[model samples]
Target: MTSDTPEARSALRDSASRTLRLEQQAIAALVERLDAGFDRACELILACQGRVVVTGMGKSGHVAGKIAATLASTGTPAFFVHPGEASHGDLGMITPGDVVLALSNSGETAEVTALLPLLKRMKVPLISMTGRPASTLARHAEAHLDAGVEREACPLDLAPTASTTAALALGDALAVALLESRGFTAEDFALSHPGGSLGKRLLLRVGDLMHSGERLPRVALGSPLRDALLEITRQGLGFTCVVAPDGTLAGVYTDGDLRRTLDQHSDLSGLSVDAVMTRPGKRVSPETLAAEAVRLMEDHRISALAVVDEAGRPVGALHMHDLLASGVI
Candidate 1:
């Protein structure tokens, strides 16, 4: 077999090196271009009464969708509407109160730029991100962000690489700036993501999951062991809470305790719950986060905890199943 000559290998290495170096230069160039127009874009979106509608064609379209998601998830109400779809029937989605964010490396993508007149006519503010400041898209936009890059990562500098990254980063910056200006909080984020882990952490409070009243398996401190077991079974929480006369949490009796107590005597009905209950049981407050409850349950290797009030009275109880069923786990 013929071996590659040193000259052939050197050419390949130089080509790869050039692509990497040019792409790095492109990113650096984009960093230098952030200015007043970028701030204008943020101001325009923040001033928008409706959602930010992001649109682009091809690679830019993919980035636009991601940017829209980031904006929606953070605080801004935004969604992606494809430029081609907008040309068809989706133009109706663009309202006068909405802000349109159009992305194009050349600022001349026919599919994206074709909707400019309609957007202008609807009186919707337009923010354009493009590599060419003199391009039609830039000149027509209410605010133009220069996402211009020095060169592509491709060896021939023909492919869309660094330009797309610059545009995506600019979109994120806009979303974050709007997020801060709106004073968006974690609760707002949870509202947008009701089914995700963030929602559980931020929105799912301990009171929402804790079993209360009769549903909370509870027995008086002096109750018989047999009666405590009955309460555990009827409540089906895997454990029964033992509270003092003043309603403060006194102790707990679990399924494991029943087994240990039963080994000594066949009849536990004569045994008082106070004599067998484990005192100072693991406890949490009604205001605690469900995520923190899960952590405590896992770290302590136990399920089912009594929820206490600020004054140390037993108000509720919670089990691992409660967290899983409530979508907080």
Candidate 2:
């Protein structure tokens, strides 16, 4: 088959489609296999006093690593230990309080199976995920999850294609179930992923990005429109917050408001800030998530928001620039 031949291209596309279909079917079958064993696996992890130690061999080992990461990030304390390394001293990492989750498509991978007796000796609960229910690993486990697939995507029926996909889907299902059972919030997930954008969305609060104290652009309600414009210029926020006599937010005056004011008349001396301000503008609490603040700004077609205290007084101000600079937008 020539690399650029039309027949070869067609075959390549067909092969990809067949592979996806096989994997999809494998995952669909796993959904029906969620039975008492699945529930028992969840129960064991939930009841575990120490972290979960996930181990597997070959392609199953790669899937095991991903599962361990997902479980760890989603509120379950988990880590992957290479099965081959377990016999070489990593077995000491497993304690009596820990739960061992072993993955193997055949359930007969020698490296993974060899650790069974030691795990049993440590009195650690063993949860096995495998395609064969009658395999050695499955027979020895306290709970056996059948991740069986009808066929491999490999044309030779020798590679771990559909089986590996089934195992990955099952691992995701387990992690999501454990997450729900633990009442894991996005904030909790962010605590484990502080360097990612998801962490920013969940952990970045309004107060963290807002201009507080003297940095906020503010003017008294009856202050001249000229004073408000000057305040906006001084703060470089494109807007100034209008405060009432008690220092509570009364309205917001923006460059857009300024344009409208200038178009109405050439006289700036007679107008008060309240006369040109957009009244009853949206306000957010200091504790609000920065993402929520961005949503509020987008929904209202406004570029700025006042951060107020419980008493409705302006404690800080936020602009689109601040959100953009903080990667909240």
Candidate 3:
């Protein structure tokens, strides 16, 4: 049972603080220990034409799966396989051309060490992350990354804690080094994660959200003020493009313009949009990034803008609402 008493809360806070410090110390120690083995591990993964097969057991397995995901998303292709499952026909998932990354705190987990001979028979290079340098798995590996920690953060000193943090940090360092070596870019990462927010930021374009074709609201250069208002109301975009006779954009009339028109004239005179519209109104090319469009809109205090062609003709229109729907705002 947990308690909210002052003494209990103080004890809880102290435990959390100690755990965080131990985990941080574990991660910090890895920096000084990174050596030739780390380089060789990167070299093996970079040279492999096949996917990287990462395997571990228990808590190490959980960290191994996360490392594999980070590797695949960052440019290297990798996947996780359970050591127990690999001995049960999943070994077929690994190819001779692939490299294997095995993690075990003791470096002697029976299920993990059992696969060493098979890996050698297949002539596949092995990269092992372990706390024990003299253990079987570490001795068999082509490159041995020492992810050892001084001690577990657990009060009982038995559970995997600091050791797991060290392994995970080491894995991230290896993956990032490989990412830079391979010239991985944000666009490449976005391609692999098109459904994510980073992908939306890097891959989404203005044309993808801007209204085009029949949905686009536009009016000729000398169109009547009533026509522009009707187009705006019909499209519900708060604005309509005003085009010249030669099909070039002349200006834009918006709800703001309508309010101004009402303020300047009391009589319903023969007013055309050319008389009240904003001349050479703000616009962007269809190829502009949606993020850039957001900046332009915010900077100009605009709620709606036009997408123009190279010749300055209206091809599409963008509204702040579309950006909101697309999660760009």
The residue-by-residue lDDT of candidate 1 on 1-329, one tens digit each, is 22398888888889878777766776677667889888899898888899999999999999999999999999888999999989999999988899999999899999998998898788889999999999999999989999888777865778788788778788887788888889999889899998888988887888998889878888888998889989999999889899899988898998877778878777766799988788889899988999999999999888889999987888899999989998876
Better of 2 and 3 by lDDT: 3
User: Candidate 1, which segments miss by more than 4 Å at Cα?
Assistant: 1-25, 211-215, 230-236, 243-249, 255-270, 279-282, 285-287, 295-301, 308-316, 324-329
Write one digit per residue (lDDT tens) for candidate 2, span 140-259.
999999999999999999999999999999999999999999999988989999878889888999999999988988999899888998999999988888989987899899888889
Please tell me which model should have the higher lDDT, number 1 or number 3. Answer: 3
Report the poorest 10 consecutive residues by lDDT, candidate 2: 320-329
Clashing pairs in 1: none
Clashing pairs in 2: none
lDDT of 3 by residue, 279-306 (tens): 9899999999998999999998999999
TM value for model 1: 0.81
Show the colliding residue pairs in model 3: none
What is the alpha-carbon lDDT of model 3 when measured against the actual structure?
0.93
Query: By lDDT, highest first, what's the ranking?
Result: 3, 2, 1
Comparing 1 and 2 on TM-score, the stronger one: 2
Task: Point out where model 2 deviates above 4 Å.
Answer: 183-199
Give the winner by lDDT: 1 or 2: 2
For candidate 2, report its TM-score.
Answer: 0.89
Poorly placed runs, candidate 3 (over 4 Å): none
Order the candidate numbers by TM-score, best to worst.
3, 2, 1
